[model samples]
Target: MNSSDAVDIATDALVVIAKISAPFLLVVLAIGLIVGLMQSVTQLQEPTLSFVPKLIGAAVVIALAGPWMLDELVGFAHELYQRTPQLLEG
Candidate 1:
């Protein structure tokens, strides 16, 4: 494909990646912020304190959103596959 088609495809892939990752990223951000605040208030500067909670939060969010993530990925793959002929012909 030409440059524009390649750029469009790259943009679409990035968007799909962002959409799939946003939930987990957001959860991690929120948890980190909260943990930071708690650490500040309690003056507990344990480096490992945030690890488990963030991990657990990430896991929980992934677990909850796994199906939706899968659906989005599947849809993206399907769309890409459907566009293969046009992409190739470009």
Candidate 2:
């Protein structure tokens, strides 16, 4: 395929990746921020304190959103596969 087709495929793939990971990333970010604030206020600078909550939050988010993420990924893969013939001919 030409440059534009390649770019389009790359863009689609990136979008799918971002969409799939966003929930986990956002949950982790929120947890980290909250834990950081708590640490600052309480003067408890234990590294593992922050890690555990963020880990749990990420796991919870993933458990809750896993099916939706899978669906999005599957849809993207299906679309890409469907476009393979056109991409090949280009």
Candidate 3:
């Protein structure tokens, strides 16, 4: 309802987002680096090489971590719901 409340919600949202995304993002980054180096060494410039591997890597990671991700998201949502009254009162 106030600037402080807005700021609080935004910061919480960002923090949760970072937590949820950091692991998968790190995996993708590492895979991308490895793929890039492989491409550089092999001198095989296939346009689809990067896209397929990265897509598969992300899909696997998301599939493996989906439950944990859901749990964290649900927890964050619950916390936000619980805080709604306090935010509104302010």
Provide the lowest-lDDT 10-residue window in model 2. 50-59
Question: Which regions of candidate 2 deviate over 4 angstroms?
Answer: none
Clash-forming residue pairs, model 1? none
CA-RMSD of model 1: 0.9
TM-score winner between candidates 2 and 3: 2
Candidate 3 residue spans exceeding 4 A from truth: none
Question: What lDDT would each prediction earn against the true structure?
Answer: 0.93, 0.91, 0.88
Candidate 1 Cα errors over 4 Å, as ranges: none
Candidate 2, 89: how far from true, in Å? Answer: 1.4
TM-score of 2: 0.94
Clashing pairs in 3: none
Estimate, for each residue in 1-90, the C-alpha lDDT of model 2 and write its tens digit.
799998998999999999888898899999999999999999999988988898899889888998999999899989989999998998
Candidate 3 C-alpha lDDT tens digits along 1-87:
899888988998898899889878988898889998999999988877888888898899899988898998899899989998988
Local accuracy of candidate 1 as per-residue lDDT tens digits, 1-90? 789988988999999999988998999999999999999999999999999999999899889999999999999899989989998997
